[model samples]
Target: MAAEQTSSVVLVAVDDTVLAQLVQAATTDALADEVTPPLTAGRAWTADRVAWLREFHRVRRAGLAGPTGEATWAVVVDELIVGSVRLKHTDEHGVLDMGIWLTRGARGRGVGRTATAAALRQAASLGASGVRADTTVTNTGAMAVLRRLGFHLTLSDDGQDVRALLLLDPEGTAACEVTSEPS
Candidate 1:
């Protein structure tokens, strides 16, 4: 499935064809600092790190039905892979965890907001009552995007992390219509 928030930004499900592009995009535009755990939070992208990145997506490709209960998508712009977005089923019933990251060039634009909006709609479609996202206090960009997307933000007591939550409508209505693209 593909969710387009604008003509410039699209979220395509992670498949073998898209997976390679996703890794390439990461190596070229993203820092290890911005990705999730298991990746060293530093500037360098070593061969081992790249290999791990490739395997990470491969293992989770099953998406909602996968053992990890997570669905990831490659964020494409003007037909080029630029970033990624994901939604994961959480232990809390009817809630999903959301994540997103963009290439350095894509940051500061509305791309993150658009991709996140699409992810929220996907969560709602999957019967989620809310979506949660967590980021570091230093990640002002992510904090701003989550807030603009209508998520309630709470700072960690240690002032190191920020948690954001957006409750969907009770009926699970999509925030906007995402045009479907054929697989």
Candidate 2:
């Protein structure tokens, strides 16, 4: 997949050179608190950053062709890197999982929504039948963005996380429905 541009943000496919910058971005307080659980365990100092990048590379090369069946991208706005988003293939055929994180400065500005919309389009082009995502229940911002993008709440687990799904039609008329189920 190639980089995609939105009205307010750009999704640049992750590459080896951007790994270091992404590691640094992940260390930011907002990102650590909102998205990356592993990084929240401790401050992502130099060594920790290096280790994270190393593992990220070892597990999956930085591109659409990565071994992990995931496509990760660096989210940029105004030429500054703000966060990252990922789309991963699931065990269920034609289904993909989407994840995203934005820095403190980028939150509540429609960056995530725009970037995600672009990603969903990319996924549809890649033949995805549906896309799903999970967000912490407390993360109202994320939930709102997903809802606005046509993702319907499908499940709520332990009052901690909520799962949402958006079914895509090849003809481009996707329908979203919201449901609530105990995890």
Candidate 3:
């Protein structure tokens, strides 16, 4: 399935073909610290890490209804792969956990906001009732996007992590629009 571009950002379903492109972006445009754990020494993208990244997406390539009940997409802009977005079924019924990561060049642009909204809509289409995300306080951009999308955010006592939750409307209209800014 193709995601209609919003602000020049389009989400392409991650298949074997797209996976290679996604991996390239992860290795080149993104820091290993950003996308995957530091399995290798000192944030270097090693052969082991590269192999791990490939397998990570391979299991969930089935899209939403796959056995994993997870869907992942490559975030593309101007016909180039810039990032990735995904939705995974959480332990809670009707709720999904969403995550997104962008290459360094893609940050600060509105790409994240557009891709996130698209992912939420995809969740709604899968009959999900709610979506949640977890990010560090340092990730202000992601926090801002969630707030603009009408999510309720809660901060950890230590103030290092923040969690967001958005309960979609029955018709999923909540995913259709974003407020100018958080009130």
Candidate 4:
């Protein structure tokens, strides 16, 4: 259960300093535990952390990418950023990939869902026909949110890992001519 805190939230872009700080803080915390061993998969947190910081800068610099293009937004609650979402169109593939993150204190409190929904709406507004996202099978929390967002599961393997895809296009034209479910 999440903390019983009441907050009126707003969605803003990544250019805002406060939102950037919040994203960095949340991302650092998320990498803290998974920074080490078995989950590391022979990787280094120092490097990954640096990469994340760079990404933070880029996301911040993205500012307003307009309605039909990639955009980053932060979920602000009570004037504080608790989460963020990134939605962009992969022109090569003609599909939009949506990404989201929520602070530790904000998790399990519906922040992710709210932010993701906002991102979805933005994607639709961007002239995108559909939106899609993926997460490791172990990410049950994210999976739950994605499922509720009407994502269709296309594939899964026995490694307790899975990949999920969603379609946000009502007319099914923005993504592709495939008006059916993903394989």
Candidate 5:
């Protein structure tokens, strides 16, 4: 028996609409520790639905926005937001960071690959200099997906966590395309 999957997964721009909430809800609900930020440990926080809602549109509408780019949407089967991904801009040199999550029931259905490809497409279209991602070493699923997307492991502190890096270049021979073509 296979797991039930979301009917569809489409990446759209995040807007001040119901669609934004749908994305946020799915991401939050999928979190193993709503109180702990995925990137870091021991950080106390709560899922601020309203805050995320406001910021999602405010930043998404920026003039620099791109299709499937920063501050966007990934619709999975109508309104059932099976997966969500984002690229947060920061002041640090390599500030473009990505976070993604898929509904528990939506796993093993390619939602992760779909959402990641959408984000990469957006990044490539936006002329991004580079893109970076970090995942726990134990997160084999994430590592596998990243590898499929051409993300190479850049740093690995012992065996606990690994930092994978992917360049979003529009010219280079890097294959940004993600499909289930048997490898």
Candidate 6:
């Protein structure tokens, strides 16, 4: 599938300085409620700039290594940082794990959908046959988006978290429409 584009959203290479700021913004009380539980470690790092910078370098180093590493991008809208998406190859061949999060202001818009679709397309380019994602059961917004993106529930052990998977077509299409606005 070709890259998807939105008038308001774009996926750009993650900038350590900007990412650090975005992470700090996410920890604010106003935005804290919008952050997913799985991202708690990231929020915590905001309190320690040194640690966050170190992690940033580590992530960058890993990305430079190979497919076994991760590919992360910043979700930008109107030239402002709004969120992030990451795709990491798993132990299983032709399969990757995806993670995404948007700021409070960006939620309920089409930013997440567009950014996620772009990440999935990137995964396909990397030879991934499928992508998996995990989200807390209570994050109904994310779950709904995953469903809309053709991801089917694969596991929901304990009811606290759920895992979903989307299998790419042989032709590499994700088989989902990239609408301009969120449903």
Off by over 4 Å in 1: 1-7, 36-42, 174-183
Clashes of 1: 0
For candidate 1, the TM-score is 0.87
CA lDDT scores, all candidates in order? 0.80, 0.71, 0.85, 0.61, 0.61, 0.71
Clashes of each: 0, 0, 0, 3, 2, 0
lDDT of 2 by residue, 1-183 (tens): 986543446777666667667666666535344544465356444555557654654465544456788877788877777887778888888889988888888777777777787678777777789999988878888888888878898555567879989889875446422121111
Which residue pairs of candidate 3 clash? none
Q: Look at candidate 3 and tell me the lDDT of residue 87.
A: 94
Best by lDDT: 3
TM-score of each: 0.87, 0.78, 0.89, 0.67, 0.68, 0.77
TM-score of 3: 0.89
The model with the greatest TM-score is 3
lDDT over C-alpha atoms for residue 35 of model 2: 44
- Kindly list the per-residue Cα lDDT of model 4 for residues 1-183, writing each as its tens digit: 886555555677666475457546655655534322234344445656545644654554443364445666767867777766777667535467877767677777666666666666666666666777867777888888777767776555666655556665565433222211211
By lDDT, is 1 or 3 better? 3
The residue ranges of model 3 lying beyond 4 angstroms of the native Cα positions read 1-7, 178-183
Q: Which pairs clash inside model 2?
A: none
- Candidate 2 similarity to native, TM-score: 0.78
Per-candidate alpha-carbon RMSD to the true structure: 5.7, 7.5, 4.9, 7.4, 5.3, 5.5
Predicted candidate 1 versus true structure: per-residue lDDT over 101-178, tens digit per residue: 889988776777778888887788788999999999888888877776678999999989998988888776544343
